[model samples]
Target: MWIKSARIVDPGQQLDFTGNIHIEKGKIKAVEKASSPMPGTMHEEVIDARGLWVFPGIIDMHAHLREPGYEYKEDVYTGSLAAAAGGVTTVVCMANTEPINDNPSVTKYILDKAEEAGLVRILPAGAVTKGQEGKVLSEMGLMKKAGIVAVSDDGKPVEDTSIMRRALEYAATFGLLLISHCEDRRLSEAGVMNEGALSSELGLPGIPSAAEEVMVARDTIISSYTSCPVHITHVSTQGSLEIIRNAKAKGIKVSCDVTPHHLLLDETRLYDYDTNAKMYPPLRTGADRKALLQGLASGVIDVIASDHAPHARDEKDLDFDVAPFGAIGLQTLLPAVLRLHFDYGLGLMQVLSLVTVNPARLLGIDGGTLKPGSRADITIVDPSTNWTLSEDMIMSKSKNSPFLGETFRGEVVYTICNGQIVYRKNGI
Candidate 1:
């Protein structure tokens, strides 16, 4: 396949220009600035991206593809298809599936299902505890041998400090990253939303910012003691950001990520009790949001992940107090984020790095660069295109997005993964 006349965006080298990309046998053959179309080769497909911005396929480091038990919300096939539609070529699946991916057998089961689906690259994360019970540690050695990229208890934090310490120590031996969902269950019990003026006005149980900050502080100390690579997931508070920044300054092997929702929206949106506005580490104060943006700009935050947790209509249709804590993001991540950079004064290259090279480096993957020998995983986006996000237009099985009906400034025109055209907008 040949992609011609594209404004290629390479985050690895901080370069963007009009160029041509050639792909053959599932690898990028060449990337060069072109003056005109070259002579046609035999049996080659051509794509004319005259006015689009081509970028490395977006990678999501945190996603939940529910399969092997909970197909009602989403399966590997549909989840990956949603990711492909969002211009994401690679996704790391969390370990909160129905049967919990705790052991090697379950990890292999998810992989086989993903292979059969063949829509996107699925890297499954193993559970930190057996059945995610937070009592006993899971078989980390066996799971690593079976191709698990990392270990995490996403929906639930590992509450036992001793067990968490042991997991981190064991994981370090195998060179595996330990991703933690930093929340103190005891402090967060029965908490419905952010603990502040909004929660007080609504009379809802509050989950204080300290509930999240305390766990982050604990994890940083443990990581420093064990010398293990620790990544804090979905940081939502100014206190948490300060902790991570200090840890990095102290030379601890620590990294962190911020969600688009956390960066764009805040707890004040919950004034109306909209269920879509509810999420774990619930939306924080405006002050926290500003600090998160500053952290991203100053390089304290390493990557941006969707945390694409999907729930069915029956689950999300309940009262705000009873609704689940998540919203689908894979289909809206690119457009929503583009608004932040292109319209809100954030640099284009910096915004692209949050989803591209930054994530690839965090996961130790090799597809985020536009280098000649890299895999042909590329996305073409029209940054100036104006469109409205509609729930009906999303490819995910769930319709729990917070950006429905919102106008956005960009759209993905084409996505090529592994030398194949996985997604292309109609009439483009």
Candidate 2:
């Protein structure tokens, strides 16, 4: 297959030009400028992307493809379809499923299901603690052998300091990356939204920013003490960013990712008691949103992930006080990032890097480039297209998105993974 006459933008390679991406046998055989033309008999498939944009397929480091147990909300195939529609060709799924992915068998099961799905690269994350109980260490050595790119007890923090320290040290011995959810259960439990005037006015329980900051600080100290590289996930507060910044300044091996919802929305959106606005580490002040944007622009934040947690309609349509704390993000990630690029004055390359090269580097995956000999995982986007997001267009079984009914400026028209065109928008 040949993608011809497209504006190729690969931030990892510092490349931007009108070019052709030639795919052969599931690999990028060539990435050459338009100056080179193909003979009539050279290929049978040609995609004339005259005015379109082609980029390295995005890698989302924080996604929840609930399989092996909770297939009701989402399965491997459905989640991959949603991801492919969003231009993501690689996704690292959290180990927060019903039967937590602590042992190697669950990891193998996820991989096997993903293999059957055959839409994108699905990497599994192992639980940091056995059964995600935060009490005993998991079978890290055995799970590593089964191919977990990272380990984290997401949706639940390792609150036990001594246990977390030992987990860090043990993970480091196996050369694995440790990811933290950065929330103190005690401070965040039963909270419905941000802890401030908004929660008070709405008569909702509040989750203080300190809930996130306290764990952020603890993880930093543990990383320092253990000499292990730790990654903080979904950082939502200015105080947490400051702590991470200070840790980086001290030469501690630490990294972090921010979610699209945190970057784009604030607590004000919850004034109407929209359950979709409910999220763990709930949105904060306008000032916190500004700080998170600045962190991404200034390189304090390493990448952008969707944290694409999905819930059934019956689960999300309940009263705000009892509704689940998450909103689907797989389909809205690009436009949210584009707002940063086109409106906030961030370079397009920089915005694209947060989803592509940066996340790939964090996971040590072999993607995020259009260079010759790389995998043919690519996404074609139309920057000029204006469209409204709706439930019918969502490929995932769940329609729990905060961005539903909102208009956006960009659209992903096609997604190719492993040289296969897994998703393509209608009419082109």
Candidate 3:
């Protein structure tokens, strides 16, 4: 496979150029100047990519591909197809399935199913506690051996400091990352939306910013003690950003991800009782949003993820207070993020880094690079293409998205995973 006349953006080394990428045996063989074609390459299937931008396929460090128990929402095969359509070649699925992915057997089941689906690379995150009960630790060693990439209690936070500390120390020995959903259950329990004037005016239960900030602070300090890598997923508070920034400055092995919704929308968008905007670490105030943007631009935030939590329409059609937290993000991540970058003056390289190299680094994978010898996971995007987002056009089994009906200025034209063309636009 040969991709010709493409503007290549290699975030690994901060390199960008118009080049031709050659792939053989599912690996990138070479990236050469567009003018220099191999003298005897007659067998290559050349793809003209003029006017399109190619980058390492996007990686979502946080996603929920409900399987084993919760196929009603999404399964490995359908979720992977949604990921491919969104230009994501790799996804790290959170351990929030029906029967939580806490044991080696369950982890293996998910991985094996994903392998059979074969649409995208699925890296499963094992649960930190057995069944995510937050009481006892799971078989971390066993799960790691079964090919789990990381451990997380995504839907709930591990509130017991002693147990969490032990998990961190144990995880460090095996070089496994501990990704936490930073929220103090005591402060956030039964809270429906962001705690602010909006929630007050709407007569809804509110989840204060401290619910997230307090946990982030605790985890960072604990991580410092254990000398292990701890990642905060979907950080949405101003105070949480400050804590993460200071932790990184203090040389603590801590990283955090910001969701596209957090970067592009605020709590005010919830005025219409749109349950899609209701998510854990709920959409925050304008000030928090501003701080999040600054965090992304200043490198305090490490990556951008969809936090693609897909729920059934019935699950999301409840009253705002009773609706489950989260919405589908796989299909809308790129367009929503690009709108903020191009229209708001964020550098293209910086934006791409949030989704590409930055996430690969978090997962300790060799993706997010166009370097020779690397796997040929690539996405070609037209930055100038304009279209409105509609739920009907998405490939996910669930149609729950917060950005539906919004017009955006970018589109993914082609997606190549392991040298196989997984998706391509009709007329591009």
Candidate 4:
């Protein structure tokens, strides 16, 4: 197959130019800049990619597939479909399902299900502790062999400091990255939204910035002491960013990512008792929002992930205090990154790296490039297309997103995973 006349931008290879990409046997065969396909290439499928942005398929390193138990909310098949629609070719799913992904059996189960879906790639995250109970370390080496790409007890933090340290140490030894959900449960306990004026006026208990900041400090410190690579996910507080920034400055191998909702929505979204805006490490003030954007520009934040936690509609329809702290986001990841480019003025390549090259490097994965011999995972986007997100537009099994009704200036027109066109906007 040949992608002709596209403005290919593969940040993984430091490449940006009008180019043609050739694929054969499900791998990139060549990247020829400012040139037409070779003679006799007409027999191959050629994609007219003119006027579109061609990127290495997006990689969302944090998301909840809710399989093996929470299929009612979302399973592997449905979640993979949503990911394909968003131009996300690879997803590192959290280990927070029922009967958590603590053992190799669960890891293999998730992988098996992903194969059945035959859409986007799914990399399971093994639990940091057994059953994610925080009492004992999980079999990291065993889970790795079973196909888990990383270790994280997302949707819940390992409250025991000793366990967290051990998990970090074990992850380092196993050559896996430790993805931390920086939240001091004690500080965030019973809180429904950001602990500020809006929560007070709405008569809702708030989750304070300190809840996440304190843990960020702890995890970074542990990472430094143990010399392990720690990745903080869904960071939402200014204080947390400062700690991560300082840690990185000190030569600590610390990296972190921000989510789309946290980048766009703030505590004010909760003033209307909107359940979709509710999330763990709840969205903070507008000032924190600006800090996250600045972090992206200054390179403190390493990537922009969806943190695509999904909950069933009935679960999200409850009272503000009782609703689950999550929303589906797989279908909005790339568009939100576009927001940073168009609205915040970050260079397109720079912002695209947050979802592609950066995460691929951090996770030690492949295919965030159009380089020769690389997997043919590409996302073709219509930069000028603009539209609003409604419930019907959501491809995830659950429809609980703060981005609902939000309009955006760009959209994915085609998503190619492993050289197969898994998602086509007009076709879907």
- TM-scores for the candidates: 0.97, 0.98, 0.98, 0.98
Please report, in order, the local distance difference test score of every candidate based on alpha carbons: 0.88, 0.90, 0.88, 0.90
Model 2 lDDT per residue over 109-149, tens place: 99999999999999999999999999999999999999999
| Residue 191 CA displacement from its true place in model 4, Å | 0.3
lDDT of 3 by residue, 221-340 (tens): 999998888999999989999999999999999999999999989999888999988888899999999999988778899888999988899999999889889888987777766776
Model 2 quality (TM-score) = 0.98
Question: Candidate 4 lDDT (Cα, whole model)?
Answer: 0.90
Query: How big is the positional error of residue 204 in model 4, measured in Å on the Cα after superposition?
Result: 0.7
* Candidate 4: clashing pairs of residues: none
Q: Name the weakest run of 10 consecutive residues (lDDT summed) in model 1.
A: 34-43
Q: Write the per-residue lDDT of candidate 1 for residues 1-428, one digit (tens) a residue.
A: 88888898888888788989888788988888877557659789888888888998888899988887888889999998898889998889999987899999999999999899887888899998999999998998899888888899999999999998998998888777888999998899999899888888999999999999999999999999988889999999999999999999999989999898998899888877888878998999999999998997788998888898888989988999899999888877877668778767878788888888988887777788788889899988887788898877888888888777888887888877887888888886
Predicted structure 2: lDDT: 0.90
Model 3 clash pairs are: none
lDDT score of model 3? 0.88
Clashes of each: 0, 0, 0, 0
